[model samples]
Target: MITIRPSREGTAVAPVLVLAQITSLQLGSAVAKDAYDHVSPTALAGMRLTFSAMIMLVLVRPRLRQIIARQWRAVISLGLVFAAMNVAYFQAISHLQIGVASTLELLGPLMLSIVLSHRLEHLAAALLALTGVLLLTTSSASLSPLGILLGLLAGLCRAGYTVLNQQVGRLFPDWSGLAVAFAVGACVLAPVAAVTDAGAVAEHPAVLETGLGVALLSSLIPYALDMVVLRRIDTRTFGVLLALSPAAGAGVGLVVLHEHLSVRQACAIALVVLASAWSVSRSPRTAPVPSPAPVSAGDNLPIKDTEHQART
Candidate 1:
């Protein structure tokens, strides 16, 4: 695997990029929710992936001919995860409020963090986040059970996506892997969208326009930023930073979707946020930077860099 040391510049910029990612992501989700009346969640997800794929492919133009078998495996795995995660998540937000769906979906990464943790404090952090989830779930009697289940499923897929994406990143050493993954995702979801909601997009041409916006805000921009940020930080740190996503989602849901959270729900989100912050505070101030992998002249493959660049 290629490992690149985190530079001072990359480290400093990571948090800012994450903030922008979450903000854009939440805003995109809220916008997507608005278009659900005209399009099914599956169709919209297909559109998002298709548009994102086109954009990334054009921008990165990955050298498909040069990709080795192992790299192809990683990229394809990540693509499948992406397809599953987006479909489940979009279905989730259809039933649950954006904030609530986001929080529930976060369990995937939180669980991943816990599994990877060797320290006691990390367990404590997990407990706190679980408590928050429990509170949020119990607080709302109106939440759809289907939404809850879908959200959890999305979380599981998200965890897989996180792991596989980092692997693909290391394999490709650039965004080329991501571009190919997006294409794979689009291919996976397009047929499902056609089977499930074939007429929605045709009937509502406006769905295409809104979908482009959603693709830009939710998929392309944030995912591109994710590639950049993942190259600069550890997965645990990345997961911890994602603790802010619930709050961002809540804000966007309120402002854009007019979804109101009860006091208990608000407190629940706060607890999750607090748990993430606590984890970060207790973590080592600086991670050990590994030396970059040596690039061979005959190797046409991109060099993987930064073992620490893996994410939640």
Candidate 2:
């Protein structure tokens, strides 16, 4: 029998890299939140996407020619979704706590998983997540209704991104599709950037640096690390680790943003995380093996077919 196992390097590197990715993402959001005093939410969002797109374009240099005419719709849709998600995310954090916003936005992918799931465990998981989100949203007074709406909208856009990313990933290689999608996001936000008083961002050297840091930390570094980490870990392990995102957000929010969560809110976040892990754990693993082919009526046998059957 042949045995296959995860490589030693993968075993050691995957978890650490994923942790780093989560840390970078949450820390980047914290930095963006701090910079809000200097720039509008939309302006900051535009700066992040625009600069990140420029960086990705220079590094990836995606070949536009490789994208077929038929795939234009998918490419454009993915880009639009990306732009919408980020814009709503920034707007959400401006009004809501970073942790709260992230947890609510997580509803998108969680609901998507539940909708497509066939297992009872996954359904249970969905309910758990839903309850958690409701608790978090209802218990908070500081968050405005518009902020909550934007967070949910961001979640919906996130679900769209998840669905479309698979299609475009198949259509392009070397992550060029993501680069193209980012480019499209940059284009989509160009008007917003032009209209916003970006001069405030320009005048403050610290804000500009923070904007660049947000771009690199939030988009470029984490995404680049994700590509590498995905190749090194199994789907189950990856999904399980991804469940830590909300916790990471909350932890970072407390430390960096000084956002405090009540006991009930903390429990709700735990429920959401557990639900994500449970859903991933309950996914159908290996496929059932096929039965052996039936013996032909006319096939010669060591013993007669009837006699052999009786003996067995």
Candidate 3:
């Protein structure tokens, strides 16, 4: 079994990778939003997953024969999560401002982190994040009910993705699992797009070209970066780090899509950010490392040590 030791370089690079991920992901969302004129959200989501799957499959060429049934289950679960999350998020942004949708979506991971920790501090952070979401949602008369519902759905799927990704990471020595997951996601979304927006793609052939860029920026780059970061950090830390997303989404929305946020909305995002910072600050500087366990031949793969210093 592969064991990952913590290094100072790993600790320092994790946050930077997260920052780059946020930028790339938010920019992709903005691009997708702008391209909505050419394609429906479902169609665009399908195209993104399809292109991502194609690129990853060609590049990684995962050995399907070697992956065990248990590993297949995890990869399939993650793929379904990806499909659901992307479709819901794309729908949410079609109705709501990208920033607002992102903030609402973040609740899933924030709540997940709090539930996993079951500490007073994490609870406090959740409450603060909830308050921010409430402030952002209730104060904005422009927010759509459907958008809110979809954003929450996306967030829930995102939480599942985070947990499942770690499991997949342990099951595979490399990115083979991710490649298979993307293919699964593509298969799942293809039919949905055909039923929901079959005519959109035909009407706007250029959307396919745009989809390639969106897939790279939104799905490929950010996801690959996320996998790298997740290998070095625990789910809780990863969730908290995503607190930067709302602000990044806001800035990208404003700059790229010309979607503006009100003062209260900005304050709400700030509250969420502060809560994330506080939760991270409250985490223990050191965690007890568990002894390595024996692995069967079927499960021989690298395992991430969640107790690593990079978790901070």
Candidate 4:
């Protein structure tokens, strides 16, 4: 169990971080969809991972020399998950309708949070979100069965990445955990994807620009903001706020991507927002204490970084 310190800074920083993560993710996806018009989604995904990885590598200077064998295993696992998640998700978005596909991608995290919360109200919230997802994904009567399968697999991969990150964050050094994962993901994706889309990158400069936008919106902004927030909130509470991500994506799509939501979709967003608010409100006002990992789990777990903040 993770103990929560009231982040003295979380009050000011958490919301900002949440907003940053949401908008960045939204713009990234929207920009990516735009990019697919020029380059294959695989190539675009590669570019985003590559650039984001570079930015963090330049800034953080992670202690590569001190890395342990176990840490290397953890890092590689996280990197593979991240790479698989990105490539599959980008491909799904390329094939399926954007709104439906995105909602699908979000399923893994939403389910994890709800299941892990183990609360009745959260169960209902999960159902609501799941129902909305069903509607969103299945509403397209002609939707390709193969596309849906790919999307759900991508969602599973995303869940794996998220779970691994939580544990990795406890051990690996700060954003270096994410940074290394993204770098490895980029390298793995680049050679295979770029070769196939070689002509697209050169033929369409706009394609490359879209990929850059995706990098900025998705990877670069969110990780830094998450670092700020992680210093404040426990992993569990952090997951709850993450539920708002899809709603943010919806808003972003409407404003920036010009993808309007139907009345039903609008209603779904309202339900998800309300449910998330209630889940957070009902949880303990003082953040839960971060428990030290079981001795059997490992001796090398990181000391949880806790900050005290004024209540919002």
Candidate 5:
């Protein structure tokens, strides 16, 4: 299991946390892409959600009854968005190369980090990311306009997912929010996937195995790691980690799939990653979003216990 060290009395590494999340996320996506030809993206998405739901339920055992009725609508909305994002992005990967699809999807986080962010540094970073995206994408006119549009939609959904997850993290605490979200996502996606993929995904043992691995890599491991990191790390650190997604995707694609990226693409990834980190480092928190009931206690630890630790 990953660990979450206590944050320092007055410091936080939110940027770094974002960076780590990006790294794991891109790699997971790359891995999932390898399985696309083997099974329908919907099937893969359904299985991923199902496993994630199971894992989260077993780990958190959240009190569903305690959730306010007012939040149910938001929960359902998040689930649908999450399911669509997963399925659509996966399907996009089947058509677009990892570097391309991931770069496009990245626009979501960059836009999100920018729009929600007021820090000059983060805004600059967002601009840098935009430039990098342009370079990375313009290199290949082979990109289908439809694929690009789909990729954009995926990015929007992902941003929605990010916002919803933030809401969940604030309200639920620890892993409970993630767990509940995954459960709902699974609930929404499974039936649709069942109807869509039907028997095609079943008869192929290799496809099933690939799909399972994709689910594990894409959903289960990365999320659990992210929660642990967030509990231990800060938002800026998280954002920094998030910046690494493109690079990670490129690396995994090259190393595992032997799909090398061009010089321009590599530079674009670097520029965005560095800018995002630079931006997040300068951001200041507006206010503390309420940590969920389950994870909230950790946030209450005494200052003395975390002497000279990482930021809040």
Candidate 6:
């Protein structure tokens, strides 16, 4: 994934990484959704974060004492954001269809892009995205208000994670900030989940396995790819490609959760996609720079380079 010169070859790789990141995250969400009956969302989220943290810790073994003193505040904040975003997303999927939940959550990044870009096209895209979200949610009266709220909350967390993670990435080595954040998030959630939902895992080891799978697919591989590919793409292009994630989530939900999308909803998704693509195609080119590499989890996962992708 190393690109010595920022050329067309390097640019071509960015979208592929983002696409892979989207696919892995949505598939992981389906797996986590399937496990919800045996384990509560909180428990599943806690387990996923804890297990990912453990894997990363074992692999990275960051110099905690030195790193902590250097950037403990940002590290701890990023971890909390990660934990909250995952919990909110799971809660949303519990009440709403995964497609709708994911579509709603994209609001965070859409808004972020608008704020950061300050481009009329981005503003137009945000409006288009809002229109799409309205189409997706209003068409189905069965959707839960609480679930939609939770998804929006998760989106907000995601936006914050993107902003803060950029700072943390600048402060630490490859994946070290992420390792610490995951460890901190795991430390925060594991005990509460253990006391409340330990029996679910004890009774069914499959839940643990599923969570581990989620961590691997959702957190480890995609984020690693994200770290590499992001350096070759500008933030504008990266954010625009992010429009693919909701569509991917919707597709995964249809296949896995048997969630169906209406014609209007599909149109809505398309509008958001078009808005992003249009904005990206119009934007002036910027030479990409290789940024720090870090592994992160789902939406709340630290995006060490470019914009942070939404966590499921």
The lDDT of each candidate is 0.81, 0.70, 0.81, 0.68, 0.67, 0.74
**Residue-level lDDT tens digits of model 6 in 168-267:** 6655657777888888888888887888899988999888889999888777776556555545554445555677777888999999888888888888
Candidate number of the best TM-score: 1
TM-score of 5: 0.81
Candidate 1 lDDT at 247 equals 82
Mark the 10 consecutive residues where model 6 has the least summed lDDT.
303-312
Report the candidate with higher lDDT, 2 versus 3.
Answer: 3
- Clashing residue pairs in candidate 3 are none
Model 3: per-residue Cα lDDT over 118-205, one tens digit each = 6788778777877887787776776799999999999999899888987777667678889999999999998988898888888888
Per-residue lDDT of 41 in model 3: 91
Q: In candidate 2, which residue ranges exceed 4 Å CA deviation?
A: 1-20, 224-243, 286-312
lDDT of 3: 0.81
- What's the residue-level lDDT of 101 in candidate 2? 84
Question: 251, model 2: CA deviation in Å?
Answer: 0.7
Off by over 4 Å in 1: 1-12, 287-312
RMSD of each: 3.7, 11.1, 4.0, 4.9, 6.3, 6.7
Compute each candidate's TM-score over C-alphas: 0.89, 0.79, 0.87, 0.83, 0.81, 0.85
Q: What is the lDDT for 104 in model 5?
A: 78
What are the per-residue Cα lDDT tens digits for candidate 4 across 179-259?
A: 777788888988877798999888887776677778888777876566556545544556556656657877777776676
